[model samples]
Target: MGAGMRAARHYTLALFDALAAAGYDAPERVPRLPIVNPPLWELGHVAWFGEWFVLREASGSHPGEALGNSLLARGDDWFDSNTVPHRARWTLDLPAPGALKTYCREVQDRMLDRLAREQDLDDALYPYRLALAHEDMHGEASLYTLQTLGAAPPAALAPIGQDLLPAAVTPAQSGDGTDAAAGDIAFDGGVFLLGGDQARGFVFDNERRAAPCRVAPFAIAADLVSNADYLEFMRCGGYQNARYWSEAGRAWLMGQERSAPRYWRRDGDGGGWHELRFGRRSALDPAEPVRHVSLHEAEAYCSWAGRRLPLETEWEYAAAAGRPEFRWGRLWEWSASPFLPYEGFGADRYREYSQPWFGTRQVLRGASFATPARLRSPRFRNFFTPGRDDIFSGFRTCAP
Candidate 1:
């Protein structure tokens, strides 16, 4: 695994422990947050999942011995992400919290020992590292769920004040010379290194060894599209206009029964929509890239503005370009590419990180405000259902 991947694994493992220690349980005495699985379920699920592919397959172990195989998979009556949905897990009468902790410890020990013994097994490193990175990413998602549910922030988590930007005036108001200036970045696109340089370290299955890709020249906004720009779309009826939305995009829009952006509320007779950030209402920060928008919303706004969202390859092309300081602090960027594996892809030390989600979901680029900075990379791939508007997501566009 690469240094970044290892850091992610350590980071994910720590967060899961923190959630459990914080006393978030299935029947959480607290409200709003998910009935987080008792520390037992989540920890085991992560460990079991790792043990199943990494050790079992690598050593030719049997499947029956796998962790949470019965509970993690969906069964006769309903769904089980093993990630959340507390009531059912609480009903299962599974292993005690202590037992589950033991399982996670065992899995971690085995994986570490195996990794150490096979330091020379250089070929396996790629897949093994991939799986760890996969688990690490999911771990980050679980944290976002905690925030959405308003679980008290973990004491160890970095403070929230840094990225929580000040609000910007609405675009209608912004034209009067009162807005953060756009950081326009120009790119002389040509043949570029499209993925990770294996020489640099571990990379995802989809982003294998970096290879050259040719592209036409394009310019990207120096930073991501911010909340202020998106609010203008809401004010201009961007979401409501079918002319600006694709058929699938429009269908999803109508179903939401939403008029303005999600989480936005009116200020008054004269005031425009203000957003609720971490529970309190805050004026929109036009300087910050918009968050909480979906692909449909992104496309609609792109159409309305006579622009288009960048493709995943285009996003990679931009991020991988020479500029060093250009990430959108965890606010995911909408991209046009569907998620898929690269040519001649193979599993690394860890398996299934990139295999399961390929082709089923759309890809977004950039880590969010919630993402660990070390995990952010131009070639990193993030996939989600197109209709998932719940993530604090946003997008930027290339000039038409």
Candidate 2:
């Protein structure tokens, strides 16, 4: 098989292995969450999506192609994400774990056969690349799903061929140390080139059509907000005070009955905070960037601190400038800008990907630890609703 085909197959297998290692084989043990998918269904869908995109859609097959032409007889009915309603997935009679694994292997083998016949791995094989990128995205989703389920860390995720660092420090080891000092980076605003370059290979639809945006002079935080910094906000009743939160945020906070960040618990005497990761509770690392926070929470914290969230334009500029001190990629940082289309936005083959969530979601720049290495790009735009705190998300401050 060609290199691209080989890499795609490798990542697909790795993701499947990771799922099994994370107890996906034991469906009864996994909890049902609205934000999460049933492991069996998720795996089947990945395989089906790859086949649909590369083998059927790319090849000019009929839109209403029969599933029997592929390996699985009822694959479309079970795994087509567009056709399958989110809530109806739990009610469907999905194939057994073993059957799904077989289907995955079968679909992958067929995809490889087609890829081997192709001479070009670039533009000629865009569908294969898209399929690979899609799978990589799902791999990150699996990791976060494990986190949301409070399951143990998967063996596939352990850092390999790297020197081991010391265990994460507990709150007792560092008692509310002052927020890590950060500099305000000032930019003389001007017209800046924004969005992805399509000629550069495999740009997402949302990031297409590079355009120039004029931004005003603005100053932004050099570093992400640390756990220590957020602790003060919580202690000062940031959640209780209505003035700090937006109207929508206030409603969400009350609906969820939340006072602190998700997965955080206070010690009995209120001297320290603990965070739950992969079903294990450990003391909060004061210096680590605070994560798993919603846009609302980040905004409220910024409000209390007399700072503001950076606009998407400022963020792209900072990243493009490549200033050494402006560290990112530790967590997906939230932007104040709502997720919207660029100038002359056009949908690619994957219509549902970017168009569906345009105005309703908030944009997040930078990648998180759980994000796949291949998907890590400064130009890549990730979006989520303001109320979502389950993902690996955080934010930095900008001058108000």
* Best candidate according to lDDT: 2
Cα distance off (Å), candidate 1, residue 233:
1.4
Candidate 1's residue-wise lDDT over 40-102, tens digit each? 455556665566656654331233433344333432122224233555554555555566556
lDDT of 2 by residue, 1-400 (tens): 2564556556555655665676665445457677788777888888888888776754322346533345677877888887888877777777887788788877788888888787664665777778788877776677678778776654655541121121121111111112233567776667767887766568888997888777777788888898999999988999999999999999999999998899898888987889987777777888888888999999999999999999988888776666666677778899999999998899877778899899999999988876655677778899989989988888999888
TM per model?
A: 0.76, 0.88
Error of 2 at 224 (Å): 0.5
RMSD of 1: 7.6
- The 10-residue segment of model 2 with minimum total lDDT is 169-178
> What value does the lDDT take at residue 203 in candidate 2?
86
Q: Would you list the C-alpha lDDT of every candidate in the order shown? A: 0.62, 0.77
lDDT (0-100) at residue 59 of candidate 2? Answer: 39
